[model samples]
Target: PRAAAAEHADQLFAGLQDPALYRFIAEAPPTDVEALRARYTRLATRRSPDGRQAWLNWAIWSFAEEAYVGYVQATVEAGEADIAYVVFQDYWGRGYARKAVAEMMGLLREAHGVAGFRATVDTRNHRSRALLEALGFECVAIHADAEVIHGRSPTRPSIG
Candidate 1:
């Protein structure tokens, strides 16, 4: 399969559409599998159009659920990976997202020479902001869009 193949997109599409998940971000979920498949097709390249960034996406497979419960995505550029993740509505409050994000950061550093990290979250999404904070990310900037982007070394977070 591709970096984000249609098959995997098909499987995860429905679960990715829970209304609660869209509250903090723009763009509603795809109305159908075909839309998702087409989108994933573009995401498979692992690179941005300008060739300045690398796109990484991984499905989070849960042993307990015996299924893919979520995904971690990163946009790597200039030695920093702007990361994002989602662990579908039914699977929230579990440690799956935390574990996956941690592992993905580790991989980005060791495999891709990413020395710093960044993440943008809607300010209203306190849980997500806390999750990034818990992972040692510091709030570096808050934008007019009501979003915040974090910047810090992954291993040396000054959580206070």
Candidate 2:
């Protein structure tokens, strides 16, 4: 639950390179470590205030496995944030994504005063859609290719 750093690039790249994990992601995973390192370097810089977007990222580590598993992130703008997450294929179906996202929401709410969140999921990604729904996010709109889901912290009143 810390900010991403350059040292994490190799493990992150290794976990993300599984093609099965990229099915619904916008871009394919980097083909090599150097490409991943470059991407991570840019991500690290975005933590600065001068960066155009407020990007919060965390590398997920499993204590039992003693390894980095994946990541969860939020792109913030104004009162709301867009959230996304990824877990290595080997760790799929273990409830890790759900737990991580729930924890992330708490951190965002407490630290950044973000009361609401939105997530866009490909229509075919049933697992992700279910995860969001389970976390109290409701599908607000459905485009031809994707669905937009919104959630409010249970401790906060809903916003229209």
Candidate 3:
């Protein structure tokens, strides 16, 4: 789905309760399914309240596994999309996050006129930083004791 929906609250909320998933981030799991439903209901709008930015969220469903792995999201403004994503702890090292994020960036550029992409990865998450680099994102700035902000243009470079 293009946006988080209340209907997926139960399934998604279950994956979110894994404490290991929050090891590098500050957010704790939602207290209950109802809270997740409420949050998703608001996110379903897919637009910031003031309308200056577009909120794009997609739930990841795996056919082979018959489960919801996680999600990818972006906030877009002025031709740049700020990206974020997650792949539940159990699905780690399977390349799901990389694939999902690449697809999201492609859709944003082709359908939404997004020319650039950006992300802030927690400094301690070395795998995430490496993944972004593999996606052609260059680290543009770093927040001390926090995240490293990176950016990438839509067009990847050709082989030399």
How many pairs collide in each candidate, listed in order? 0, 0, 0
Residue 60: error of model 1 in Å?
Answer: 1.0
- Estimate, for each residue in 1-160, the C-alpha lDDT of model 1 and write its tens digit: 1145667886799798898888887778888998888877777788889999998888888889988888888899988888888889888888777888888888888889998888888888888887887888777778865665665665643322
User: Could you give candidate 2's per-residue lDDT for residues 103-140 as a string of tens digits?
Assistant: 88888888888878999999999999988888889999
RMSD of 1: 3.1
How many clashes show up in model 2?
Answer: 0
TM-score-superior candidate, 1 or 3: 3
Which number leads on TM-score?
A: 3
Name model 2 segments beyond 4 Å from true: 47-52, 156-160
TM-score of each: 0.89, 0.90, 0.91
lDDT of 2: 0.83
For 1-160, candidate 3 gives per-residue lDDT tens digits of 3457898888899899999888777789999999989988888898999999998889988777788999999999999898998889999888878888888888888889998888887888989887888888888777875665556664742221
Pairs clashing within candidate 3: none
- What order do you get sorting by TM-score, best first? 3, 2, 1
